[model samples]
Target: MSRDRQRLLDYLVHILEAIARIERYVDDLDEVGFLTDELTQDAVIRNLEIIGEASNNIDKYYPEFSAQHDHVPFASAYEMRNALAHGYFRVDLEVVWKTLEKDLPELGLSVDKLIRQLMDENSGL
Candidate 1:
């Protein structure tokens, strides 16, 4: 694979894997019950940070590709990461949970589509 494509693919995989981990961590727990424990919350938050960082990396490294596929909220993820990383004490956990539960599924699908597009485009290059 080309270096550029590899970089993009790495970010995509990081996001998908992070989502998988988040799902696994919250697999049996509902939102109301899940936040009581700190371990799971911390794990999920770290994974979310990973996702946001990966999204930020993609935006910086491949702006054209990112702009072409704007359905995914890469900027929001980055902003979330910024908030979590920079404002750790002030983050709204409810918002994080809601976003993970709702927004992530659609984002995952979009990431998959972007990966496929990257693979198809890079295969010819």
Candidate 2:
């Protein structure tokens, strides 16, 4: 595999790992208010940022990869990451919670699929 592709793959792996960690914390939440916990909030936002960065890098090498995956919200996800990373003081926890609940799992699945596709393609080559 090309170095670029390898780097993308590494980023994707990091994203997946971060997502798993965030999910572990989130899964323990019994009520909506649980999102108010500072640790949980921090972890979720950080993982989302990682996911976005990885997705963005992957898209850079394979623009069609984002469109092809269909499971991940590549552009919007990255935008959210930028907002969280750059505008943390102004970011709304409610929005972050909603995003975690609604979008994260889908994004994780999409990234996994993309990673597999890259692996398969590399093997074939």
C-alpha TM-score for every candidate? 0.92, 0.82
Off by over 4 Å in 1: 122-125
10 Cα displacement, candidate 2 (Å): 1.6
lDDT measured at residue 59 in model 2 versus the true structure, 0 to 100: 68
Assess candidate 1 and give its lDDT.
0.87
lDDT of each: 0.87, 0.78
Model 1, 6-70: lDDT tens per residue? Answer: 98899998998998898889989898877786898889889999999999998898899789878
lDDT of 2 by residue, 49-87 (tens): 887887677667768755676556777878888999999
lDDT of predicted model 2: 0.78
- Per-prediction RMSD in angstroms? 1.7, 2.2
Displacement of the residue 13 alpha carbon in candidate 2, Å: 1.6
Cα error, residue 46 of model 1, in Å, equals 0.3
